[model samples]
Target chain A: MPQIAISADSYAAQFAAVKRTAPLAGPLASLRDDAFHCFDRLGFPTTRLEEWRFTNIAPIVEVPFQAPAASGGLDREVLDALPLPRSGAPEFVFVNGSFSPDLSDPSGLPPGVRVRSLAASAAGGAGGLDVLTAHLGRLARFQNHAFTALNTAFLRDGAVIEVDGGVVSERPIHLLFASSSAPAPVLSQPRVLIVAGAGSEVRIVESHAGAGDVPYLSNAVTEVSAADHAVVDHYTVVRQADAAYHVGNLAVRLGRASNFSSHTITAGGAIVRNEAGVVLGGEGGECTLNGLYLGNGRQLVDNQTTIDHAMPHCDSHELYKGILDGRSRAVFNGKIIVRLDAQKTDAKQSNKALLLSEDAQITTKPQLEIFADDVKCTHGATIGQLDPDALFYLRSRALSKAQARQLLIHAFAADLLGHIKVEAIRRGLDALLLERLPMSGE
Target chain B: MLEIRDLQAGAGERRILNGIDLVVNPGEVHAVMGPNGSGKSTLAGALAGRDGIEVTGGSATFKGQDLLDLDPEVRAREGLFLAFQYPVEIPGVNNAYLLKAALNEVRKHRGEPELDAMDFMTLARKRMSLLDMDDALLNRPVNDGFSGGEKKRNEIFQLAVLEPSLAILDETDSGLDIDALKTVAAGVNAMRSPERSLIVVTHYQRLLHYIVPDFVHVLYRGRIVKSGGKELALELEEKGYGWLDAEPAAATA
Candidate 1:
């Protein structure tokens, strides 16, 4: 393997360590080896690459992050202290990238629905491993993404879910990944694979958070496959520690007449990057992608999304909004691709950022590449501060200047909040966003 | 209840209001009439403590307190309201929510118990019917997508709800049809009480016919050069402001 000089020594040592301890054989082992080779060739991307132009990963590459040690003990208090609602849904908790059965509740799940740890299933050669192996690495390609390659190289444990055909899950499944402080900075790769059978409907809530003020790197990858006529609602909430680095990749494939929607809410992180790629593989498929990122202090948040219309009569809509305060920075890149054969394709994308301070910055790019003449595609972006006239109007209504600013900011974000269909998730996000609003000076 | 002494204010380098003087007591409606660029809106902005309209000279007192020394919201809490000539459109903020929040703020400042959502809704619905406003307007964004006349009527509807002690209607009659003008005038007339005062600032005498002003002052070149009873508005309307421009030197001297 050609060793790329960018953070070569640290990654090489880490890869060697993982290869020695990773319990894998047969095809999975070969998959890991291939992924490790790909990562070795590509290394950590620099700003020179167009995909990584806006977000710089120097901090992540310079640090040598060993695989986190197995969690020793379960902290019930920390788990309970999370701001999430107790909605009686089945929850799977993972600490330090290792599943903690004591902290997970798998009861109340209907028949034909399975929620289990990938490590457990892969080790025992369980029946679900067949489904896992078929769809895990199929959707998320590691050819161009260094982070995705790294995650696949170290993917030993994560949540694996499958719903049978024609079954509708009434309650959502919650996957909580909590990272605890370690003596040294650690790296955790949590892999998630979800497959909904034909005509099934399901909702999943995935959250990544830190236990305390510890610094860590969380590289996560999620692959979803929606069979013909299936519907899925997926929400990923990233509330990492202020000192944490988080990079997540989501790849989804939709079948004929299937519907898929994903909401990625990024509220906390020192440096965060969320990349989502959706493929309308079958005719009449529909996809909706919405995101909200709230940045304060010196945080840097980046969202990159791509929607590929590979078939005819497919539609996609995307909206991403950002609220930046202090000296924070944000980046949004949305790309919509309509293939030549994908006639009658409909797609729209919009990105808006509200800067609360003069120093806060945002960079947005919306691109549409249409190869078919019969397709209709539109994309636009906007960055601005609060409207002065709106502020004055609210002030005239007896709201203080700070109150007026807060209300307008809330209104800007409420448009995306309205897309969340889950009540508990919606309410939780609303309260959290309100609490995170920066206090204005009189 | 409201007093202004040689009030001089302007935005940036251009002075809009120069040495203006006016006074209005409780239960009285005073109409300040002048042609365009006569600083009519500047007078209203100065009274409501709008930003960018700097008070370069003189003072304004409402209920014995310096109104210019307070913030816009503080002035509002102190029972001073200015109906904007151009009501701003604030999208995504429900009209009922804005009115309820404003009412509660004013009540809280007076140490009175604030109204709950149910109580505020009941109160707002009553005033909405008074102004002949539709119930759907309350659920929409504040003045967003409303017609020009509806926006004007909404402003008066807010005034009725807040019940400020001193109301400065700044060109509230500028962009309204005759029927819509009558609705707004009736809403203002309904709010008139012995304990409250109104300053009707307009460029035309048509609105004065409905909400008849007790006193009419003709403001020329930044100063109120002529003060008379309600007939003064009629006289200016008949002869136009061209006559006042020639006699301003004599009036100022």
Candidate 2:
């Protein structure tokens, strides 16, 4: 392919060039080359696209990003300072996108459970290739988002784990992905493949942290497949990055009688876009998605989700809430589709946002597309400020003005956080969110 | 004691309280009755230091400080409360938690030791029982999904908990049925004491029957056009406010 004309230093151009470098030279190279071709054919999405009307990717497309640091990672002391999950919890650590065995827990893995980085899987014939080739980028169509395709094409080091049928894990597995934004505008693509075998259960916690003062972008894609009667609980948390950009995708394919739930908590990052897609490929499958985003200063956070039901007897429920202050902006787009053959589908979606400042802005869209004759689908979106009457009511009872406003916002965000089935994780995110409030305004 | 001197206040550009004068000494219950839109609620809002009221030319003193100069919470701290006509509903905030936070804030301002959760729970339970409020209400979000009767009762429940020195009930009887009204009135009557005063603002004299007023004032347009003893409320209830409108405007001026 001809060399791209875009800025060599920009994130968009650099990502495009990475795709051009990977080719079908060998068996291992062929997989990379195929992903690259898929990514090249589908470039960055624009506002003109129907699914991206409310989101304008022009600003993200113009910036160039260097690859993640290959050698030195963040200071160990700083990593310890971060509010990570308990150390005893089964953990997998990724330093600057590459999985580090020395920093991970490999023992006590359940039977049929496999944990390996994408880099190792590239060199050797491994577990995720078959599933990766069939399902990767299938739900999160890259034709619309160049960024998603780019991540898929150049994905090097992340995690790939498969659970055996009928196995249940006692301890939760945490994926800690951090990047050193030393070089300005560093770009990291972390790819993960999760397979929940039939009748198995697992919980995955994915978190991103950075330790550089300069700006950078962390682009990631995680694809999950839950087999028949399998259950998966996933949580993605991002926090405390003042000069960074994060674009991530979480896609899931559900089997018959399977259950999937995801909780997303986003408190920090200069700019972030979290995309989640779920395809209910079997009957009697259910999914629940909940999210909370608290942004201040000039931070911009967007959450876009889609749930597609292609079989009968499927159900999905989604709720996302945001609290925005200062000049921050938030966008929420949730779409649910019931295909013609997906009879008896039940879907409900809601997005609500509270703006605490006159300068803050929010855009929300809840969409439902149903082709099935027997289905129940509903969607709603609301954007407003804290109710003045409620504020005064709390104040009259003796809470200070600031306390009242903060309490109300917390209560608003709590509605979603309460849905987190995990106790430790819920409490963990709650403490972090409380300490972050009045963040920029105060 | 509570005092007002030629208090001229208005909501927006239109005037409401025009050159009004009233005083409520400790242990007294004063009621102000007028027809619809006669600035009765405006007086309560102004006295409680709500956001929209414009005090063009007047002074309101609660205890010994300027009440209008304080914010709503400050006014509440200084022993002033306004039972709103339509209490706001805050979802996800426990009713009991909200009450304790307010109580603690005022206590802190007064240099009192903060109550622990157990102490506050005991105190709240006692007050809720007085208003016949179920303990379940304390666990639910504040006033969320409450019926009109329940909302009014909740306001009185709060009044019993906060125990302000001077309480202003603004149209508290607007949506109550006879039974709920009696229960609410009884809650107010139970809270009445020599150390506290009450200012009841209403459109009808029905509420005054349960919580009788020491003094009654007739407010027309933005000004308290007439003032008299408690018997005047009966007179106005009998002879509508039409006479005040029929009289020459220049004469009232």
Candidate 3:
């Protein structure tokens, strides 16, 4: 795969702006410098790279997007109506990559659980400073990914959640990184780090939603670490505005006997790339990755997932679905790797796409590498329109042709919602699909 | 009421239902029986407006309107229903939703008020119980992962809930055991009224003993070869349809 040539001049202006607005000392400042230099060395990807062959990020790279201002002038009612943010759940809101304490609520967090601002925690001699520095930027590699490098270079504020050993959080944590832009196109890079300690269980919902309709870019990075015997359920929802651009990366690691599952839903974006990498680093661990992407009106959603089984007695299951309407396009590239020592590893992957129009399209590729002899790995990809039999069946039940089509489209998405655990998230997804699935100009 | 005047149709290049003319009055049970490849299913498909069958000639009228000219759903809302021989399995769509939406569509066409979820569920449960169907099946996806008997029972359950004026059963008792057949027949029998009509299509003469003209009509090679009273089914069962193939005059019926 050929790489894009990145000169220092590409990010020189943004790097200078970051240094002037917010400069850090100690390991933080050095980490930022290294990440910036790495980003400068390895610039934005082009279609030449095999991973980005189908999705072009030129729309994002061409625009000169300055760092966003504060999240002011947004209607509280409008902000309240974003759907991804739930009431009565411990909520944390971030505007344009800056943490908004006024809009956040962590009132009901139980004992041994803490939600702290990543920047504030990084700045002071924080209570969890060692934990932050140890795991931050560790799982998500910046050496090859320019987006991660850029996110790290500008990652001064985000949400850091820690579940102490033996703690169980009953309430799901909702982190809404709402972005609004008006005067100029801005770029918001938000980072989230979650550390679930030994024997602890936690659920987190990280949503990056566009609060305004103006054209902007949102690049987010989230890292989740599950210790021995810990359980973590994570959800990442990215529903941007019509003209917005988005790229979200999630990196997770599971320790011995830990269970980790992540549900990713991408409803709206002009050009969206969702990348998730999970590694089973210890024996007897189980990991599940579920995703559904809905696109319409020239929208392109690219999903890439990697499940790495590094130890024996590990199992991983991945299922990703896509619904494309109008002239939109979708791509799924899932890679699963089992190391030489990882015997008794069972893995299954399924990627299915439903095209609802003549111009809609999908491209899927599955890459699996298993060195172990006693491993079972299987994968299948299906691309099809709404089943004619199902459509006829529904229509024969007195549903109109349009209603039948919508029901099948809704069924394609509701099938994925059955796997989503959070009630609020499930309701939000239902509302999102109801709002977006009818965009067919027919 | 349905009136078919020399309806000719087929799947593709091969013609089936060649000059099929039948009139079904209200409060009547007409059994259309035939051997395999005799257009029993083709007739059902053609009448239901299924795309597989292309009508080449003739016409069908239902309730004083042109049935052949309407869409499948339109025909359905106009009180026409066809119980499929091999019901399609649709996942992620529950039976309650399907039946409720279907019932609402029919009711809406009749200018009747729609039923809410509670009222709809009550109606669905009552109808399902009458068919001996499990209430859990109402919440399950439409015939998905269901047994053959269960699938057939679900079809009757939907018919009972939708309350169509003309119900066409195309081989409804093909794969059913004796008990399921009785339960299904009882369900169908329970819905019989002076204002409703039935066109029971099957190959076996055994089903009529339970639902019992259901007038028996023997179809062969896409045409009705014989039509008679209830005693005809017993004679066909005793002598078999091979006797009809031997007779040249039987095709004129």
Candidate 4:
């Protein structure tokens, strides 16, 4: 791979400072050491790699970012003013990669359910630390992913969700990661680990937002494991500031007959990239990955997904839609792999983008590799402007040109929005999208 | 209410509507009938201001205003409506939502207050029943997964709801069965008023028997070859378009 000359000395210094401050004494420390060595060797990924061909992280590597320090003089008003849904669910708030107990409300959680900060879990002695070490770095492999390696090396605080067997929590879990501006460009690594036991069901909504227009970087990784017969609904909403950069990764593994679904909604960020990977390791597992991205004003949004059907009778459905305007760019790459023993693996993937402006651009790739003869796989990508006939039809009914375009664009995104079962989140996103639509005057 | 004088239009380089002349006063229903590819749909498309159907020459005036100069929505706001031959399906757009938006826009243009959701639903339900349409169709997406007959009925339903001053029905009878044709024709007849006019464009003479247009003009090769009373439809259906082609000059005169 063609490697860029990233500032290795700066990253090493930052890593040393973080390691010196928050030293873990056992296996977790060793894990961090290993990940640091891997990240040091690999550095930042370049466009030469096959997977990173479309998204270049040169901007991320070039920035001289320091590890985010503990935010002082917390902006309680700003955190409360965020446009998150007040769905009566437990919320865990993190600022600059560290959990804020004053801002979080983790009360009223169900019996046998554990929701706490990873730092608190690590410091609370043996029982919780065992849960953290068991599944923290297992599902999210950092071997080939340079960002994931870097995130693991500096991961100090995030959310840890553990739902005991046979318990289905009625309330959804909300994790809010808010970043504030610093003197220098800040880089925060937030990690999340979710373990849904057998027959347990839970919903989690993770959101990342920046407080100001200051340039910052948010590198986050979330790992989820749904045991047999468990159901998990996971959502990630990224709304960073205009001058910020975000790179997020989601890795999920499903057990036999488990059901897992993820919806990633990206609306803001100057440069944003999301990678989601799902592995159906057991038979009869089902997974659905849905995403919606809106790019405007020279913004860049990229989504990459890989679904692996490792066993027979598993199914996966993926649909990603993007709306680009004002010289913006987007990329969607979906890959589905059906192993040799994965028979009757029904998989479908579709990526559709609406380019509202002449300068807007999108590159979509839907790839499928099936080894089993009995498998059913279909993939399609469509990139087009609004349908002229449909536009005329709406106009013929007295809708103005602007109104008709807005209606059709909203309709194009309604299907993906319908997949969000959380009523509050769905409604919130609907309003946000409508408000962000490019005005006709522009 | 409407006048088209020597109207010439076409798609791309091919001329479709060549020097077409027609006129309709208030309270009149004129049926423009023709065989396939006789530019009947092209006339409707031109009137509706569809893209690519360039108006090469002549003029079309609606209620003393230059119709060609206005946008399609502007024309609709000024009380002109075209019931499409094949209504486009817009998935995920609720039929009721689309109609409400259209109704509000037209109402706003006419200096009337917009209807709230309850008021609009009541009005829409009344019109739906007049057209014998199921209530479930309004909750679904616009024409999406609808049968051909359902789509046609939806056009008429929209007409009832919008209640335009001049309604242009372009081949609305092509995809309907006998019962559906009767229902659609009855719906059209119900909307007839002294202040309103209708242009019922059809390929077959069967629809005229139900609505009974005041004038029937045969559009052949981009021109009206014959114009007569409703009986002309019966004559054309009996003798076929071949007779008109056999004596084009005499028929035009």
What is the Å distance of residue A147 in model 2 from its true position? Answer: 2.6
**DockQ, Cα level, model 1:** 0.73
Residue runs of model 2 more than 4 Å from their true location after superposition: A1-28, A40-64, A69-72, A83-88, A101-145, A366-368, A428-442, B225-253
Q: Assess the local accuracy of residue A425 in candidate 2 as a C-alpha lDDT between 0 and 100.
A: 67
Candidate 2 docks with a DockQ of 0.63
Please report the candidate that would top DockQ against the real structure: 4
Candidates 3 and 4 compared by lDDT, better number: 4
DockQ, in order, for the candidates?
Answer: 0.73, 0.63, 0.77, 0.84
Return the clash pairs for model 3, or none.
B31-B214
On the 0 to 100 scale, the lDDT of residue A240 in model 2 is 40
TM-score of chain B of each: 0.98, 0.95, 0.98, 0.98
Q: What is the lDDT of candidate 4?
A: 0.89
Candidate lDDT values, in order: 0.87, 0.80, 0.87, 0.89
DockQ (C-alpha) of model 3? 0.77
- The candidates' interface RMSDs, in order, read 1.0, 1.0, 0.8, 0.5
Q: A1-442 in candidate 1: lDDT tens per residue?
A: 1224646667777777777876665677777778878888888998999988989888778776777654524488987776544466598888867788998899878887888898877875557567766887889999777888888888778888999999998788889888776678778777899999999999999888876665789999999999999999999988887888999999999999999999998888889999999999999999999999988888899999999999999999999999999988999999999999999999999999999989889999987888989998988889999998788888888999988887788788877888887787778776766555522211
lDDT of 3 by residue, A188-299 (tens): 8888999999999999988877755577789999999999999999999887888889999999999999999999988877888999999999999999999999888889
Of 2 and 4, which scores higher on lDDT?
Answer: 4
